[model samples]
Structure formats: C-alpha cells, structure tokens
Target: MSDDEFTPRLGKSKGEDGKRLVKYGGRVLAAARLAGSKTGVLTRRFDGSRIGRGASIGRLLSSRDRLAGFRARRAIVKTRLVRMAGNGFAAARAHLRYIQRDGVTREGAPGALYGRETDLADGKEFLERCRDDRHQFRFIVSAEDGAEYPDLKPYIRRLMAQAEHDLGTRLDWVAVDHFNTDQPHTHVMLRGVDDRGKNLVIAREYIAHGFRERAAELATLDLGPRTDREIQQRLRRDVEQERLTAIDRRLLRRMDAARITSPAHNDPFQQAVATGRLRKLGAMGLAANLGAGRWRLADGLEDTLRRMGERGDIIRLMQRELTARRLERAPADRVIEGELNAPIIGRVIQRGFSDEHRDRHYLIVDGIDGRVHHLDIGRAAATEPTPEGAIVRIAPRSASARDVDRTIAEIARENGGRYSVALHLRHDPSASQAFAETHVRRLEAMRRAGAVERLSDGGWDIAADHVERAAAFETRQLRDRPVAIEMLSAAPLERLHGADAATWLDHAIASSEPLVLRDAGFGRDLRDALAARRQWLVEQELAEAEGGGVRMKRNAIALLQRRELLRVAGEIGSELGKDYVEAADGARIEGRLTRRLELTSGRHALVERSREFTLVPWRPVMERHVGKPVAGIMRSEGIHWQLGRGRGGPQIS
Candidate 1:
C-alpha cells in the first residue's frame, strides 16, 4: 500500500447528523505501529482478571479478610480528629502537657516525647509547627503484647514509616510512650498539614482499617506469626474472661436470626473454645443454654460484658490504691459508681487520669459518709489541680438554666430583648447594685460563650429562647466538666486540728446540720480532728464548753481566718521588707495584684504598694489580672472589682 493510502482521512460523505466521520482504512494498523514506534508504547494493557497494584488495592484486600488464617496479632488503635478552631489549639497544647505529665514513666518520672530520629522531642516545637494547621490527628496505639518489646519507639517508627508510604505523604508527628497503664501504649500526634504545607486529608477507610492493619503487620513481624499452641493458649485464656473476647465475637456473628448459636464449627478447636466460652457466659448470665449444643445469647450481651469488664477494672484499681495506702475497707463499703444525693465531703485519697488518652480524670475520695468512692471528674483541664489530701465538695452540675438567666431574660424581654446592669436594676428596684452586677457578669459569660450577643452600647442582645440557649450552653459545658468541684480546704484533715486556719472541720462544727459521721475510715478520723480543733478553739477563746459540746463564739470562723491571714501576711511582709496593711470594708484599694495566697479562710490576693501591701479577698475575675494593676473596693459581701475602661468598663461583683 502507498503511504498516502495508509494515512487516516475523513470520509467524503457526511453522516445522517451532518457531521463528517473519520474512517480508518485497512492500512491504519500499519500507521498505528509506525506511531507507536515513534512515541514508544503509549500505554500497556492491564490484566482485568487480576487484582490491581497499589496501597489502596492491598488495603481493600486486607480489610475484607484481614483476620483469616493464622491469628493476627491484636493491636487496639483509638483515633480522634481535633479541629484547631477557636481555643482548640490551646486544648491541644494542654493535651501535650498532660501526656508528658509526671509519673507516666516506668520509674515514675514524666513521659518523654520522641520522634522518628531522636529520643527526646520538643513538644512545644511540634505544637508551634501545628499552630496554624486546620486540624490535628491524635492516636493511641496499644499492642496486646506490647510489653514483650523493650521499647515502643522502634515499632511505632516502623508503623509510621509504613503509614507515610501508604498515605503517600510525609507526616509531621510526635509520640510519647506511656508505661503508666497496665498495657504499654504510645500516643501519636500527627499534624494536619503535609510536607507541601497542604491540609492532609486521610482517607476514612485508611484511618478505620488500613492504619490498624499496618500496626498489626508490624507487631506480627516483630513477634512472629502466632503458633498453633499460642493461638490455642490465647483462646483458652479468653474462655473464662469477663471482657468481650474473640470467641464471643465469633459466636455472636454466627448466631441465627433467633439469637441461638451452637458449638458445631468444622474446626474442633474452635468448637471446643466456643462451647467453653458459652458455658462461662452462661454462668455470668450473659448466655443461656437451650439444651443439646444450642445456646441463646442475652440481649445487650456485648454491653453487659463490656460493663462487667469496666467494673472489674475499677474494682482492681480501687483495691490497688487502697492497698498502697495501707488502708483497709470492706469491699462492701467500696462505692465505684452512683448518684450523689448530697454533696460528697471528702479528703482526696488519690487523683489521676482515668482515660489518659482522652485526658479524662478520676478521683478516689475518702468521704465523710464513711465510704470510699471513685468519681469520674471528666476532662483534666476543666477542673483545678486537686492535690491529694485536699478537702473537696463534689456536687452534680445542674444543666438547667440558672436563676440569673431567667432574670436576665425577663429584664431583656421588657427592654426589647436588651439587657444591661442599669436595665436589670430598673426592672427590679429592690435588687442591690452588687446583685444586679452579678447578673451582668452572668451575661458577660454567656456572651463570651456565643450564647448571647454583646452590643456596643454595653448591653446584651438576648434572643427569645435565651433560657434554652443558656441551658444548652450549660449542657455543652457538662461534657468537659461533668460535676462542680469546690476546694473546701487545701489542708488535709490531720493538719486542720491545731492549725490557725479556719478549716472545714470548724465549719462543720458550727453548722446546724452537722455531718453524720460513721465510726470508720475518714469519718472516725474527722471526728477525732474535730474534737482536737474544738479544744484548740477553746484555748483561743473562740469557743467554750457547753453540755458535752463546745459552743462556738460569735464570728469564730472569721476570727480564725483573720488570725491566719495576719500570720501569713506578716511572713510575706518580712520577706519583702514592707509593712502589712489591712484593708477595711468600703475602703478603696489600689495597687498591683502581686500574688495569690490560699488562706484557710479563703483564697486571698496580695496587693502590693510601693511601701505597704494588703491581702484582699480574691475573686475569680482577678485571676487574669495577676501581676497587673487592680483597683477595687472591699465590700461587706466581697471585693467589688473595677476592671477596664473606668466606670463604663466591666465591673465584677
């Protein structure tokens, strides 16, 4: 054929659509071969019958049948995606500090942060790099047999290396190994951005399955594939375990529509394991035998078993703490979980994170009710640092709208949905200026929370559903702070007897409804302390003997508080070589808030002048103004703090 004949050309005749069509002549194959030789093979044909290559294909294959054949090594991976909006970065910083907090090491030192190359990693540097990132990735990876490895860094580095290859991006991450828990684990924090300064979007499928599979692969590599003997041993161990186990999961998956299962697997080993597990579950009331080989699993069996496992862990923790303290309490007296009828007045026995990965904290309190109770106090940052041996009052946080919210709503309703301190006072003429200012503070808090709007005219724009918004705001707050914790006394019960401070024991003695004490544990100890304190009060002429009980003189608590304040002030004055001045009620005080003093009376702020200093009652508002100038008036109720643009500025009651 000639070259002209081999060339492609449009047909002379048009199609029915009036568009010319290209007709490939028989010599077109020769032209294509000539073009292919010039351009090199444009594309190669892939085998449609075989599985494709790449990480995604491997992930799909693994996710579908990952646990088949030999028992795969178990690794628990918990993940959280935190958006770094508003104060989220601040919370992330706090989480880093918490993970590196003291007593997390094998020798009870702080946890050490490390990266791929170094044994010591700077958490601040990592956070600084992530400061502008849109979000962050947090993960807790725990291998079931992690303790078998001496250090987790090697395994974690390998896992992350595999992840980087799988995700096709370089991950900026830092991790801290925690030996504090029963199972050694690593907390890995990956920045949201990739190497090219772009937001790293990980596939949800990869996060859900691929990452865990990678961890299992690494673990299995290090520990070798599970032997038949090892697999049988683990299965045997799971038969009587209270927690949800693999056997239980298998049985659950195999159950018929009637929720009936039978130990009749083709594999004799699995059948025996299932039968043994069912009998154990039957004893635990989680399963019922239907005679023969059939068994009926209970409704909510998974939840019941999970809860049982948690309760068992809690009891073990409680017993461990109590034994460490050398304190003896009957198991019957131990209260792990319950609703508090009244506030729990107790000396803190121990306080630590319950779920370290989530930063959830717990407290073991020795209550005056004669019971040792364990309380889950939610997030660590939500509550103040409660030192061990401090006396505290824990009450359930109310989610309903406060009376202040109702008052603000009522006032705003009459004033065209606008509320101000002036409007609050005008609405309720009988309300004190200080009381009305309290409502303004409440409004300021709500405004900061975006539940209400603050206008330029020093007023709040309240919506019609203001009360509901306030309730919802409080409900959101409950996620972080589940309960209200008040530090009644910073001192322990043993130190309160002879001390000059006005302790909780003194208040308990003066109250009409005294705490009912049992003759056991902290109750008996508190009773003795109260007796010694009463004797000390008599010596100080603050109380007198009266019919088997001492009668407290007028203002005994105030007197004791004043005594301690004077003593502490004198010491502070001597240290600074400055005179100590006491501020009188209605006196206008102006100076710098130097530091805070936690007196037995209450928390007081030390206001320092050029020549003299005075200890004034501290308000929560003053915390942000520490080391800054403050001007306020000492009132009968409390200090009336004046903050910001003169009188028009914010006034905290």
Candidate 2:
C-alpha cells in the first residue's frame, strides 16, 4: 500500500450514498465533552447522585456577582478600543504622532516605551501592513500597582500573549507607557485583523470583563495578596481626596434619611475608621452630626469638591509656570477665577497643555497689571498661535450681540421694515459700500438660520424683535468662538525699531492714552525696547530730538502704515511671482484662493488675480475653496466675501 492509501477515502457525505448528519454537527463534535456544562442542564455523578436542577442557575448568578464585585473593588484594568477610520495614510500618521506626544513615557520622553510581540522600530511598516484594514484598534490598558516589583512592559506583554491564546490567533500590537499623571498606564495600538488576515471581532464580554480579570489575576500571582496595611493606607488617603472620594461613594451607597450610617460589619477597626471620616467631614462642613447614628450631608457636596479639586490643579500649574520662568507673584495676584473687571494688557510668555490628556491648553501672559495670568483657552485647533512676545488683550470673555446687529436693525427700520442690499445703501448713503454689503450678508446669514424670513424680491422681512433674534443667534455660535481677540499690531516687538511699520510700540508712543508700565516681567523688557525705539527713530530721521524729547513726524503713523503694507506686499509678491496690487476701499476683488499666512494681526489669505495678487483677511470658508475662484468686497475693516461668481450667491465673513 502507498502512503496515499493510509488517508481516508473521500466520499460525498451529503449525497445519497452517505447518511445525513444533524444540524450544527461540527459544534456537537467540538463540545461533546462539555455538553453537561450548558445552562439549565443537570449533571449526574458516577456515584449515582445528581446535582440540583437549579445548579446551573446558581453558577450563572455566582459568575455575575463575581464580575460586579471585581469592578466595585477597582481590581480591573481600563481598556479602550479607538477606531481608525477614513484614509489609511492619514490615520497612520495621526496614530503615530499621538502616541509620540510629549510626556508619554515613565521617563518623561516622547514615543512609546514598549512594543509587544513585534519590533517597536517598525511601527510605520506595521501600520502599512494593514493599510487595507477597514478599522484599526488603539487599546489602552492600565493595571493597579499590585505588581510593583516587575516592569509594566513585561506584564503588558503577558496579557497580550494570553489574549492571543484565547482568541486562537496571533496579533500585531504596539504599546506605550505613560507616567505623566497620577495613574501609571500603557497605550496599546493593535491591528483589527487576525493572523490569517480577517477582521477579528472581539466579544464585548471578553473586552469588558475578561481582559481586566486576566490582567488582575497575573498581577495578583506575581505580587501576592495585598497586605492589610496597604489596603488601610489606600482607604485613609481616599478619605481626604477632594474629587469624589471613596468615603463619599460609600456614603452614597449607605444613605438613609439623607445621611450615611455606620456599617454593621462587626469589624471595630473598620467602624472606627468610618466614624473618624464622618468627624473629618463635619469639620470641613461637608457633613454634620444629626444624632447617634445620623448625619446631614451638605447640598451639592460632590460638585463643590470636584470644583475645589480642579482649582487645586490650576494653582499647582500656576506655581510650576512661575517657578520655571524664575518669576514670582504676590499671594493676592496668584489665583484668578470668574470674569475680570478690566482687560489685562500683556505679552504672551509661554503656552502649555492645561489638561494634557484632553488637549486643553493654557497661556501664560505677563500682564502690565504686575502679575502673570494663566488663561485656559478651550481647544487648541480653534486657537490662533499668538507667539511669545506678542502683546495681547485678555478681557473677560463676553458672548453678546455686537453693534452690527443694531446697525442692521436701524437700516431695516428706515426701509419700511424691509432690508435689502440696495435698501441698506439707500438708507445709509454716507456709509462705505463694503460696509453696507456686510449688513446684507448678516441678513442673509439670519435668513438661512430661519431666524428671519427672506422675501421674493431679495429683501428680508424685518421683525420688530430682529435685534433680539440676532442676539440669540450670536449666543448660539458662542460655543465655537468663545473668545474675541483684537489684534493691536501685527509686527513683532524686536522689529519695531527702525522698521517700516507703525507697530504696537509706535502706536503706544504716539497715542494719548497712558501706557501702564511696570518694572516686572515683559513690562521691564518693553520699557527698554521703547527707549531703544526712540533712538532708532531719531537716527532714521523719522523723529527729531527737540528740547531733550523726541518728536515724531506729523504723518508718521500713516507713512509707517503705508511703508509696512508695501514691504509685506513685496514679500507676498516674491512668493507668488506676481506684482503687488493694492485693492482700494470698497473695491471688488476676484481671484483664486492661494494659501493662508499667519501674521501678528491675524490670518491672511493670498488671492491670486490675473497678473497681480493681494492679501485679504482670511475667512474659514476660503480654506476649503483654496485654488477655486472667490469674489469679495474689500472694506477698510475687512472683506465681505461672495462664495461664488454670481452676485446672488452665498456670502461669508
């Protein structure tokens, strides 16, 4: 017989020559030995004894209770699966950048600290291998400090190995250890596919309960059971924590008559600890004694504590920033909260992450008020980069309707309760044409939002409460533009000396308003800069030394502004390879959008016209229309953009 004869002869089992098999025959063969383990099934022992009919029910209940207890005890790992959608190339780049952000590792370094099951250096290539993968995984895992003896990377690797075994396939994953916060944790980015190259769907229970329990089990095995002294110490620390402490959680669980009663655990040490915590809370005004076994908890206790905790963090941040700069603030000027009575005029000193995990940002400004203010600006993307040394105005943010709404209402009232571009011009013939067009754009925006109705003849039906409606609209948009930043001057302080521009320093010197000078950080620096600027002006013949004081030219502000515009135009001209063309006030600008440049004033967009080009205030809409034609009316203040070629097309600010 040949080797092929040893192989079983193949037959059509589904055909008439063979017997039929039961449905799910493969499952039966695979789980034949575990048939008795199914729910609601009773098992018989070899001793001719049978377990109770409710045995499986009890088992199910026990398993659920165990999981619930594990979660309550905080003996579980934190794991998340962040999906990577859209273009594979963009996702790959973003993922790598995110994991490599500052302060990501235990050593306070950039990039991941560990890689599991594969080489860490080949992260890009690993990402490329799954370029066609529809969804990728970024799993974050954190374990309790139970196993403090071993390195976090090896423990994480063991967990991943266990996962591979349970899933019956190999996995490709990379991990990073972050110790920047109180919690020491690891971030694991795993490919969504299995070894055979198919989408791997993990069961929700496995992700939620199984992974955590497995990690906990391995940690417990390595470190042994937690000592009583450690457990008590943890509880003691929790009692004094500001943000949602464990004691508060326990009180919530055992509340009666709006108060927490002592537990009847019969453990004297635990009972004494609970009573001591109650007494501490009473002293802090968070709890009060009502009787032998009752207490009165403060209203909104949790919220107040959480706010205090946040303020504490803010204080710590302020101190750190000041220390790093080798600066100090008076105790009264150290902390600032709520709205400000007056705007703080200052130079930006530094920018940093306020809540690093959430990407919230903060700016450290050296104010002329003789103090450094830490301003928490909401998000990073919406914030314009106000580079260090740029003077800025930090006012209490107000989200109210501006004068534009009032102007619109007055124009409409004069036009028989109807507002149109032509009617606006007729109402205010003295107003600049571009300015009149802005009111029309405002009306168009209101009409689109359904706050005002547009008539068939290109006029708006102005209501008596039109101003109120517009105010409501502005309030609704406040969430995105939380702060309104007014640019004083776009030129850097260093270039203000002998520069062909009327910079902020020049404006400060020429204006009648008093300059609030302080002998402090940035303020002292500004004083020296202004003195040097005067000398530079005298040397350039723009100023003359008269009676021991410098006097500027009569049209110095205007001349400097013009010279600066020409200098900026020259720079843009070189970049675009076209001549500079200045657009007169109210002139129509039609061109293809080029690129946006960030200057001291704000963002500006270069518009490439036929043989010449110009720079105008950049609008968000122009970003999407880059390389496409854009038409707008340029005013002294800003441009009122027509989105398309047609006059009746949509307009944007």
Question: CA lDDT, every prediction?
Answer: 0.85, 0.68
Over the stretch 463-566, how does candidate 1's per-residue lDDT look in tens digits?
99999999999998888788889998887777889988787888888989988889999888988999998999899899999999999998988888888888
**Candidate 1 has which clashing residue pairs, if any?**
none
Off by over 4 Å in 1: 1-66, 644-649
lDDT (C-alpha) at residue 537 in model 2: 76
**Candidate 2 stretches greater than 4 Å from native:** 1-227, 260-276, 289-295, 349-361, 379-382, 406-418, 440-468, 487-500, 517-519, 544-551, 561-590, 599-603, 609-624, 631-645, 650-653
